[model samples]
Target: MSTVNPNPSAAMLVIGDEILSGRTRDANMYYLAGELTKLGVDLKEVRVVSDDKNAIVSAVRALSTAYDHVFTSGGIGPTHDDITADCVAEAFGVSIDVRDDARVLLAAHYAARGAEFNAARMRMARIPDTATLIENPVSIAPGFTVQNVHVMAGVPNIFQAMVASVMPTLTGGSPLLSQTYRIDSPESTVAEPLGDLAARYPDLSMGSYPFTQDGAFGTNIVIRGVSGAQVEAAMIELANLFPRG
Candidate 1:
């Protein structure tokens, strides 16, 4: 019999002064959390840091050592402030430069559009020696991965594109399965029963979400576990406790 690990862990690093300064609202963290969950990768921790190189390097090192995979978004672009590639290289003790392969790809892309492949634009080709390029279908500029760390673009479209490119290379365990039960009762009414249910099923994660609709209070209880049998068994207990009419 082969043993399969039901959970793989991941962390996210959102690097940009804009996100920290409130100039840019982060969409990548939420997007990644949902996608990783579907892929059976539990997103355990998330950090939003400024464009400071030390901050990026520190975060990259910490997350890379702590999780199965570390995903970084932002600072990989052509502008003067774009420094993700360099920071990632420093984190891994690797040197970064504009390699011929990446430069050729960028050159061809700009030439097809009758645009100049100027020095500033060439900055996008600066990938670390220890990294592999991440394909960007939306734009020609490439992201890169070093070890377990994946560096991606900050723009929502390009960030999503890079993610699609990287997902195929990952190995996912059992998909995280979940079921939700909506009860038309205030959480205070069912808190005790819910707590008891959670304690009974240590392998399952039970959560209570409260909402107000039409001035009526209610709670949505979610039970999640790797095994369908475990989730269903917990659901049975939950239903029996509530005892629908």
Candidate 2:
């Protein structure tokens, strides 16, 4: 039998004290997961780190080595605590400084808006040696890529825009397909058969989500796989086993 190759795996590192303190609820991870799914990149892990240098560097090294791609959001800002670029450089053992190309970009952007590209804002231009920039159309300050790690802005819109800039450059595998079947029965009622169905199709992934609607319990069965045929077949079997009321 021919073996099907697995999708490219990815991990996300969300860096900021605000996220851990509950002051900011992160929307970047959710958005990245969906976008990567469409691009056939499997997001296997997520990590949130504070503004601490050791924490950020350690997490970056770990995730970069563990996954095919690592996407980081937050901490590339123009503030004292925004040290993601520095930590990323440390992780890769690379020197980082304000590169001229990035500086020119920021300067022109500020000039057009009649704003001074001051020293504080100039911090945004600092990039690691030999790293490529990820375009940020939303805000002109660009994100950078060093090794397998891609660092982007913490702002939701700019993070999304950077993801858009980065997505087209990576190689992807087969797009995952999924189908959901809603059963007006409790999970306990469907557990045995669902388990059996899952066992029969080891190539596919099946999950049962419990929900309460109008004081009644129900389970939504989702079947996912790389092959559309497999997903559809499993979905049909799932529906047959647990028909809706």
Candidate 3:
């Protein structure tokens, strides 16, 4: 029997009334999920909550405690609706204050653009006392890491960049190995064989993604495992069972 390694788990909290109301489509959830998987941090759960303070606070506290890391996107801007930072601080039982480092970054960013360093922009400087800043390259309004929670921007590019900046610091397990095979056959014909292969390679996860195109049914069988050797062997077995014509 193969030994299973303990892996770090994470969750994403997408806080925005726009998303909940379907006004804005969420791109961060899938992006973060893929990035976390690459870092060997399995993204187990995703929650999309409205911009209510209580809702944000409760979700942040719950996910941060349950997973090795929790990421929150949206509601960190300078507008009236932006309240994620304050709620996160409250959830962690910490005080929210204008961080000196963040203030400097924000001030420099605005000054460089010849923009006003007004009260609205200063709102971006408020961060949790116990947190460290995550650098935002596009805009200098810094994201923060308090305990296991990383609060980042809602903009996909900035959020992705922040995730890239933080990923190197985290300890990751073995990267997942995956294989895919495309078959012109219908899913019904392949289901039994797929099940048999899954039983044989119990350590590997198998999935069938089906599609209908050009009046024909097609499926893509994907097998993923932590061990490269196991994944290759399973792919070979699957190929032997379902050879393409």
Measured by TM-score, the strongest candidate is 2
* Model 2: lDDT of residue 103: 98
Runs in model 2 lying further than 4 Å from the true structure: 1-5
TM-scores for the candidates: 0.95, 0.97, 0.96
CA displacement after TM-score superposition, residue 147 of candidate 2 (Å): 1.1
Judged by lDDT relative to the true structure, which candidate is superior, 1 or 2?
A: 2
Query: What is the full ranking by TM-score, best candidate first?
Result: 2, 3, 1
What's the residue-level lDDT of 129 in candidate 3? Answer: 95
TM-score of candidate 2 to 2 decimals: 0.97
- Residue-level lDDT of model 1, residues 1-245, one tens digit each, is 12234677899999899988888889999899888888988888999998898999999999999999999999998998998899999999999899888898999999999999999999999999968889998888999899999999999999999999999898887787899998888999989999878887887888899999999998999988888998899899899888775
Question: Best-fitting candidate, measured by lDDT?
Answer: 2
Error of 3 at 164 (Å): 1.6
lDDT of each: 0.90, 0.92, 0.90
> Once superposed on the true structure, which residue ranges of model 1 sit more than 4 Å away at CA?
1-5
